[model samples]
Target: MSKIVLARVDSRLIHGQVVTKWLQQSAANEIIVVSDELEQDEFLQSIYLMAAPPGVEVIIKGTESVKAYWENEAAAKNSKVLFLVPDLTTLREMVEAGVVKEAIQVGGLGGGPSRKNVVKNINLSEDDVEILEGLLAKNMEVYFQAIPEETPVPIHKLIEKYKTL
Candidate 1:
């Protein structure tokens, strides 16, 4: 069976850190980016395709199609995949749909109006916190770590620090 070596939620889907560090650390040869928005944009898809390392295969698919894609025999064999989703909501959807059941590495979430900084690179809104809490309740391992060399910060600790904000 194909292995989901790593599942990451990073707003910047494919970048230097992903290609140079995380991919090497996870030893993943395939990258499956789950994005509803990007799935329809061939231009953006091409950008991500070009950004990925030469040997790595990258496939962009909508959230709804992930389960079916994972069920494919070809997809399940001879592949070590690093799955990428943009946010916790997408991660939750994949987990609930049984497409992803592994631990998730939370990366850059980017700051916005209602969001608060949880770590150096991670920012979360109330809804993001709630989704993360729900994932924790489901026994999912969710943590934030910008790079492979850095120590991961547990989701609960960030929740405790930002719950009152």
Candidate 2:
């Protein structure tokens, strides 16, 4: 079956690091971006479609679309699926909606007013940490890694280290 090879919450959606680092590392040929905005937004959809590698099929679908597609036989075939959400809330929604669970969760969260902690070059907030913890509590593997080479700090451990900050 086509398992979710990589699941990331990147505010930027599709960019260089994703095309080069995460996609290459995961060897994912298809990127299934689950975003309601992208589904209805032709401009955003075009941007992502052009940003992704030509060989890689980038399918932008709404949350409901994913839930339906994953249940189909075509999506069950052996394919590397990457789900890109803008934030943990969307991830939580996907899980709550009965969409397929990811084997691992990676955070590529970018800079924003909503997110600002500079945890080893990766910005984070207490709320973000709490969401990560919640996902971990649900038995999902969670970690913060900018790239594959950087030491992946466990979300739970990081929360303990910077909870007081």
Top-lDDT candidate index:
1
Pairs that collide in candidate 1 are none
Candidate 1 per-residue lDDT, tens place, 1-165, comes to: 788999999999899999999999999999999999999999999999999998999989998777788888536578999999998899989999888899999998989999998678888999999999999999999999899889998989999988766
lDDT of 2 by residue, 35-121 (tens): 888899999799899999878888888887877877784356777877788777778778777564765455566666766564754
lDDT of 2: 0.76
| lDDT scores of the candidates, listed in order | 0.91, 0.76
Give, for candidate 1, the lowest lDDT window spanning 10 residues. Answer: 67-76
- Superposed model 2: Cα runs more than 4 Å off: 73-76, 111-121
Displacement of residue 24 (Cα, Å) in model 2 is: 1.5
- Per-residue lDDT value at 162 in model 1: 86
